[model samples]
Target: MLRRLLVSLVVFLVVGAIGSYGLMRNALATPICYFDSVDEVSVIGQTGHIHIGTLDNVNAWVGTYLIDLDFETAYDVYDGRYEGYCIEDIYSPDNEGGYALYDAEGSSANYEAAAYLFNQYASSVSSNAERAGLQLAIWEAVFDYGSYNLTQGNGNFYVYNGYLSSAITYANTYLNSLNLFNPDTFNASGYGLVSDDNPLSLDPQCYQDYIIANPIPEPSTMILLSSLAIGLFGVFGIRKRLLRG
Candidate 1:
């Protein structure tokens, strides 16, 4: 009986391992493609959370952020959806929404600037004013590129609330301090795009700008690999016992 059980277990694990690897490739590849159904906006001293339905036809929890990343649906979408694009898509050829970047084009500069801005100012966002300011600054980074002034214009974004002007001004201070919008000093391979479904089919500027970081789904991957190792170990122990018996 033990021998039979061991054989069945081995078969099950081998099959599971294959399926898991495929899922991992789809889930981990291309910056983890997702539809991002939830849109929880950030409030004063409080951050919003969102749930995602990944492209693998699996609904996985990505991460929690101050503002949800989406192309169209607006629940807590910092501002209304506008025609926007982030970085260059070097990962997915079909334009599946979660593509990677290399700081190559205007889109690249937009996201690179946003990445730099987020790296600098995202940690100090304690108040809603600071939150609003940081978000406004990110928008400015994506839309206007090198410009720092937060005034509304023909092809630029203004502060969502007139009251949050100082917060934005404060946000711009750090970017000015660094002075590298597309700073090639650090690696941006971990950053990926978060856009609507098939954004490339349109003019590529008919959606809100958003990005999905890489560290979000790491824990689940670790867990999957660990389970496979344990299963293999158990199979060997069972086979040894059966031989002795």
Candidate 2:
């Protein structure tokens, strides 16, 4: 009877560990989302295509949406569809900061601001104009140095609109509405940075970010799951000794 109890407990632990590990794997995995479609007439594509990447605050996000590779010059990646399994993060640790995000010493800060921008004002985007505006707002936060302004550089960091345009104007509206809203205070847990090196983006002024309704578990949850296996082992040892006695 004792041996049978022990076997059942061991089996339960094994099953639980396997299930937990599978869940953790799915949670920690890099997210996969579809570009779906875009309202812009970019040469990239009207569907399953978008452009985004950044280098720093000093350099403009030329044809960038969320993932630029360097600061020496904005490398354009305007060729892949990135529909199902064509996107990848070419982040190199020793590429001399081959990416502007890290070169400018503001990678984390940029993402925080970008994430905030997405969370704060990405829901009402129903048109190309709104999308452009949101993208511009995200860029302002991402390329932000010590201050936040989209029109303050010799031409490197300056972007403007001629009339009552929706893109640029809407972006300013986003910046203005969130005056005291600190990006640091924002909680960006469910979202992640999606990047691709194929089919570089075309126009930087019309870049944008979109949403997908898929959420994954956090890193902490993964830790909790991993710890379960060790804990179960300990419990099993204690039970085995007790049963013997």
Q: State each model's C-alpha RMSD to the native.
A: 12.7, 12.1
The numbered model that scores best in lDDT is 1
Best by TM-score: 1
Tens digits of per-residue lDDT for model 2, 1-245: 65676677667666766675455434422332222222212211012111223322322212223222221212222323221101112122232211111111112555555555666676556565666566666655654533556553422233533421446667788777666555455555545443321122212322333221113344445445556667677767887788789
**Which residue pairs of candidate 1 clash?**
none
lDDT of 1 by residue, 89-137 (tens): 1112222334322121123556666666666666666665565556556
Backbone collisions counted per model: 0, 19
- For model 2, the superposed segments whose C-alpha errors exceed 4 Å read 1-108, 145-156, 189-191, 194-217, 236-245
How far is 40's C-alpha from truth in model 2 (Å)?
14
Residue 137, candidate 1: alpha-carbon lDDT: 61
